[model samples]
Target: MRLLLLPLLFSLFCGSLTAAESVRLTNGEWPPYLGEQLPHKGVASRIVAEAFALQGVEVTWEFHPWARSLQLAERGKRDGSAVWLHSSEREEKFFISDPVVESGYYLFHRKGYSFDWQQIGDLQGRRLVGTRGYDYGAAFQQAEASGQLRVNRVTSDETAFRQLIAGRVDLFPMDKVVGFDMLHQHFSAAERAQLSFHPKPLRSDSLHLLLSREVPGNAELIARFNQGLAQLRESGKVTQYLLEIQQPLSLAP
Candidate 1:
């Protein structure tokens, strides 16, 4: 009876430990999508948190620079990173979760510039700015190589937008939805009035949650996350959550 009781107590302790397990999550300050502010609660953060909660997994969030966050995750310093673009390089370094959101890159310019780019060559002689460390797809890369476009690469979307507004650059690349949200949330009415998004978007990409390769059972964790995400999508909760936090701007006259 004493031996049996000891085994039962150990099993109970293991169960308690599993029940209270938690993981540390990290993300960058990307406004409208992920940021250190209100209302913007970071769309990817919210979705991933909700999904993990359903699995009884608790997470603590740390905010760091985008590059630093990825670095930490890759080095096994953090459990996972949020809102990452899936890429071959990243895949080799981290375990990626199911895509959480779809976003496209668009060209933004001063309101008066004509939006007529039939080909990459059309952008030649025009100054363009884009976020550094982002892949705007192969076409833009080809244009840059051919000297068809003058490119200025900045570290953040806000920096790119500010550069365009300050006349430091002629055009900037941004995600259409995120660009609109930033304009609505951060830009003053006057500043927003001076900016406009081109009708043609440059590239479309999916965003995913990335886990550190060092995390125990990383593949299993990503599989669980994907399963949860699928359920959220099927229930339409994912789209609804996106819309709820997305504040659209009304163009001022």
Candidate 2:
């Protein structure tokens, strides 16, 4: 009994000495990945929280529009934000973490549109809708900029999907899991049946955590987060957590 108590007491003593380190991060509604309503605030949130815990830090989250989340974090109004595709502009502003999640952006389109594409150029001459301010990828941006592809930018994901189903647009690219989750939540069985995503991904992108450089100690914090993340990966919790969040959409009805 004394031997067991000795180990427990030591653990408690060390834990008390290093308690209460916490961070506030801005997040958005990108469900099954990160959302305000999903279990454990969704899987990515759970991984992030657990990673921080491994480093003896705690996390508190604030939900906002994706753009608003970036704005607040960039201004240092929050410590940082989560789950973004990295760009050089972002790298200049924040201390970015190692890959937090594996994400794929597939082009969603209506059935019977006869769509298939092996390259970005294959999308030329097709009408596409994209959510304003979302980054699809460099190839996508270059195609859009050079006029090889024309896209109608909408303000929200629902609008984009609605446009596709209504035949107002030929295609919309979205995260595979997110697109299906949205379909399951917002569309009728028939409406969902009309939409399908091409199996080929626009870009296989890894989402990341961004720690604002404007916030003091965030540089070190990011390092700690990365270390903790590595530990989590080695433990296979990341893979297990992902599978539990589950699967995607196909246009077969």
Candidate 3:
């Protein structure tokens, strides 16, 4: 009886240790999906936190500018960063997780600007505004790098939208819902009416968490996150969370 009890006691101790395990991650404001003030810091953050919780790991978040968030994660000051598009350069520096969220990107422009595109080539000579530290998609990236299209980079999404409204750029591509949220938050009702997005999606992209390679044991950490994410998906909670944020919008004037 004493020998059997000893193994049970050790198992309980190890289980408690795993239950207490926690990690801090960096994140940025991209409301309805991710924001400091939003509940559970928005859906993406909530999903990440809950998924880790499923694996008995607690998560804390540090909010910063998107670029700064990436830097902190890259330097291993934090465990990882939530929600970023994939790029070849990032793949080398971090262990990318499974798709954390579905991100539909669309082209936003002023109401007066006539924008149309059938392919990447359609953007030729158009003054496109791109936000830095974001990967629009593979085709757009390839076109921009080869000078087949003209893309002027901005430091933030707000700046890109502002430039578009001022007619400084021919078009601005952004996450469809994120773009709408930004416009509603920063611009007046009239201003919101003056902006519109093309119905065609630029990319139906998947956002992923990036855990830095500089941190020891992060490979295992990423694996755990992916496994937890798979559980979330299998349980149908992921779709339920997404449905809550997709309130019907009257975007057109």
- Give each model a TM-score: 0.84, 0.85, 0.80
Q: Pick the candidate with the highest lDDT.
A: 2
Model 2 gets an lDDT of 0.90
Clashing pairs in 1: none
- In candidate 2, stretches whose alpha carbon ends up further than 4 angstroms from where it belongs are 1-19, 248-253
Error of 2 at 22 (Å): 0.9
For model 3, residues 1-253, the per-residue Cα lDDT tens digits are 9999999999999998877889889999889899999999999999999999998889999999888999999999898999988878999989999999999989888887877887989889888999887888889999989989789998989999888888888789898878777777777777777788888999997899999999999999999999999999999999999887776444553
Model 2 agreement with the true structure over 96-207: per-residue lDDT tens digits: 9999998888998887889889988899999999999888888999999898889999999999998888899998999888888888878888888887788889989888
Which regions of candidate 1 deviate over 4 angstroms? 1-18, 154-156, 166-168, 250-253
For residues 24-45, could you state the per-residue lDDT of candidate 1 as single tens digits? 8888776667876745357778
Model 3 backbone overlap count: 0
- Comparing 1 with 2 on TM-score, the higher-scoring candidate is 2
Model 3 TM-score, all chains together: 0.80
How accurate locally, in lDDT, is each candidate? 0.81, 0.90, 0.88
Better of 2 and 3 by TM-score: 2
TM-score for candidate 2: 0.85
